[model samples]
Target: MSAAIFHNPLLNNGPDPWIVKQSDGFYYMMVTAGRHLALRRSRTITGLADEEPKVIWAPSSPGPYSHNLWAPELHEIDGTKYIYYTANDGGGDDTRRVCVLQLSGTDPMQDEWIFKGAVNAEHPGLDGTVLPHKGELYFFYSGYGHFPDYGSAIYAARMANPWTLVGPNVLITAPTADWEKQGGMAINEGPAFLRRFGRIFLIFSASATWSDDYCLGLTSISESADLLDASAWDKHPGPVFAQYPEHGVYAPGHNSFTISPDGQEDWIVYHAYDYSEVDQKRSESRPRSTRVQRFGWTDKGMPDFAKPMALDTPLNRPSGEV
Candidate 1:
């Protein structure tokens, strides 16, 4: 697997990537635009580049969730597949909210997305992720406007049902530390959880989303510890992954992890810019182009994610395949 083969953006103009490994040997991915939910699937991670994504769902009315769709994640729970996403009212920032939709068929490609209505949270939240930990299920999302500073914070709550939180939101991670203070202000968003090696780790994107300094941060609670207790987990002082000075990939954020076809290799899929010359606040040019790279552990067993590969690197198929 040459680096050149893995360098191309898997999906151009796509932002806030959410990925899931289906049982039928394919990877299903979705991201946000203002109007509709775009979806794509492929056998190989790189194969998603050539695959044409479709608008699987869209706003049927001009209401609170009619526009500004962001960070759409697909989850399979109790034999049903659901997509959790963030949306704002009528494409306005003031009405931003989180909602879930149910997919009818077993195959995500069949296009049977049915609106499941909104998931009630204690406050306005975005980037919702459904993760099962231990014998319980939890809903992790980014808290927006709940704090006085208006900075994004990561929160969690037990899920009594797949679409509803059972209690008040528990604050997990915030941007008070120095490492999280880069890019003008400290903002922590995009919460994704992974239970690996008997530890429950929460991976969140940090820094100002529009800046080249945007990157990932991590925190974890031991399997034996109470996840709802903020003091039980430890937060890494630095980023887990971020922009590469030499590669020129900028503002890499809002990512999800997936396993290879053989389930032996880990890959991080996210959105980034091709050049660093563009102004950080330019929304038009900051399209969330998709990219993927191998992820693993360091010598101390913490996550070791290398600099993102250039947009044209060639890589082999995941291990144990052609």
Candidate 2:
């Protein structure tokens, strides 16, 4: 199978992309901003760029998360599909809150999303990712405050139910290293954890999300170790993926991974900026745009994200007739 090439800013004004492969044989994706939560679906993974995303959920009142809906993710657990996202009530950064909603139909497009309320936790949270590990459901998100410096850290907890946390949140990773210190902010946000080749790998977006230095960092835990243990996970010491020097793509982070139609290939869907000067502040130019690329496994069985390809280039499709 040949690799496919897509460009930065795949969507006009989208950011914080979250993608899920639905049982109905379509790729459903969502992003932050614009009146409501935008939903996109496509039969082919690469074809998503051409599909018109619809607002599945919107804010009715003026509040912190009312206008700025960010990082919306869809997960199907125990025969029910749930949309997890972040928003603010008063239309500012401080009011940003993580919330969840229930989708009515089996198919994401035809379904009606109902507000399910916020997931209970200690501090304010954003970028919620729901992952099931070993028969137990786990929620991974970014936590603020606790650290006197006001840096964001990755935290996780068991889920008693799909929309609720079972216990206190556990701190998994923080911005203690140089790689995570960029854009003048000690930050660790946008966490996505996966197990491959007997190792539990947690990939996170690091650096100041608003700066061009925004990149991805990796941490790992042995298959035999407890994932909730902070000591069990080892930080990679550097970024797994970041901006492309020659391609002019910058601030590439907050990504989601999914399999192709045949279910044999791995692809990453993320947002990036075409211009280097666009800071993290929300704007038309800095809108989180979606892009996709083939993910290769290294000799050690970990993801080898050497360099992201240009979004406008065309490459070979994954194996299996697509």
Q: Evaluated with lDDT, which candidate comes out highest?
A: 1
Q: How do the predictions measure up, each by TM-score?
A: 0.92, 0.91
Per-residue lDDT tens digits for candidate 1, residues 1-322, read: 6543455577778789877787667878887776788778888676776788878888877888887788898888877888899987864444676898897888776858888777777767688888777778888888775566547788888988878788778888898776676777778899877767878778898888877888899999899887789899899888888888588688888889988877899888888887773555567855768887788887776777788877766765566444
Q: After superposition, how far is residue 224 of candidate 2 from its true place, in Å?
A: 3.2
Q: By TM-score, how accurate is candidate 2?
A: 0.91
Model 2 accuracy (lDDT, Cα): 0.78
Q: Model 2: residues >4 Å from true position, as ranges?
A: 1-9, 63-65, 91-94, 278-283
Tens digit of lDDT per residue, candidate 2, span 1-322?
Answer: 2435433445766678877788777788787765577788887766777898787778877755576677888888888988888876654444566798987877667778888788875668688888787889888888785677647888988888877898778998888877788888988889886679999888999989877889999999887877688788888988899999687678889988888788788888788877775434456644657777778898988898778777666655644425
User: Which portions of model 1 miss their true places by more than 4 Å?
Assistant: 1-4, 91-94, 277-283
RMSD of each: 2.4, 2.8
